[model samples]
Target: MNVNRRLNVSEVGDVTVVRFVDRRILDEANIQEMGQELFQLVEEQGKKQILLNFAGVEFLSSAALGKLITLDKRVKSHSGKLILSNIRPEIYEVFKITRLNTTLDIKDDEADALAAFAALQAT
Candidate 1:
């Protein structure tokens, strides 16, 4: 697709690795733009294994979380998988408080997340 404005997209093996361009994902307008880009990866690009690396992301709004929830559903509908990695403790606490930690597959780091994806492929 066209150059992603809010994310950097790449592929690692069979997984699509995505990194945020914005560290603070709090702007309402940007969140919507980000959501569309994320959905395009699954809907048009037909990506199944998606991993979001949040190493640079320090803030995530609830609206952003809603987009992730929707993205997770879209991935599942397509028989795909989505994993989140390298979330900072502060941002992670938000996920924990929202109970997203239980719903989303999160890993301590990118390596761990990739391994988890491989494990899923093995089984």
Candidate 2:
């Protein structure tokens, strides 16, 4: 559950893109810590957009999903946007089954996600 083992992040324009490179996003207490770090980054940066690239993530837990919910709201409160990108099929299925696909913005790639965020900000 080492938070250090999971998340990786970088900036894309005004977007803070966090890539969860690990296979497991939950099943440990560190997920919460990772969530906290992401929360703080959004707050501190005044970031208007985010792209969560799940390309490397193979599995997700309810805890990780909860973190996503937290992040979604954090971005929303700032009038910012959060876009989930590169979701694998298995993980995407989980999101679909949980109906979270309705609550969050899912995209096929980084460019599409960033474009959607830009459009949201433009409005």
Q: Which structure among the candidates has the greatest TM-score?
A: 1
Minimum summed lDDT over a 10-residue window in model 2 is located at 1-10
- Cα lDDT tens digits, model 2, 24-122, are 777667787778777876787576677889887878899889999999998899887788999999999999999999999999998899888777768
Model 1 over residues 1-123: C-alpha lDDT tens digits?
367999999999999999999999999999999999999999999999999999999899999999999999999999999999999999999999999999999999999999999999999
Name the TM-score of candidate 2: 0.87
- Candidate 2, which segments miss by more than 4 Å at Cα? 1-5
Candidate 2 lDDT for residue 46: 70
Off by over 4 Å in 1: none
| Residue 49 C-alpha lDDT in model 1 | 99
For candidate 2, the lDDT comes to 0.82
**Per-prediction tally of clashes:** 0, 0
Instruction: Kindly report which residue pairs in candidate 1 clash with one another.
Output: none
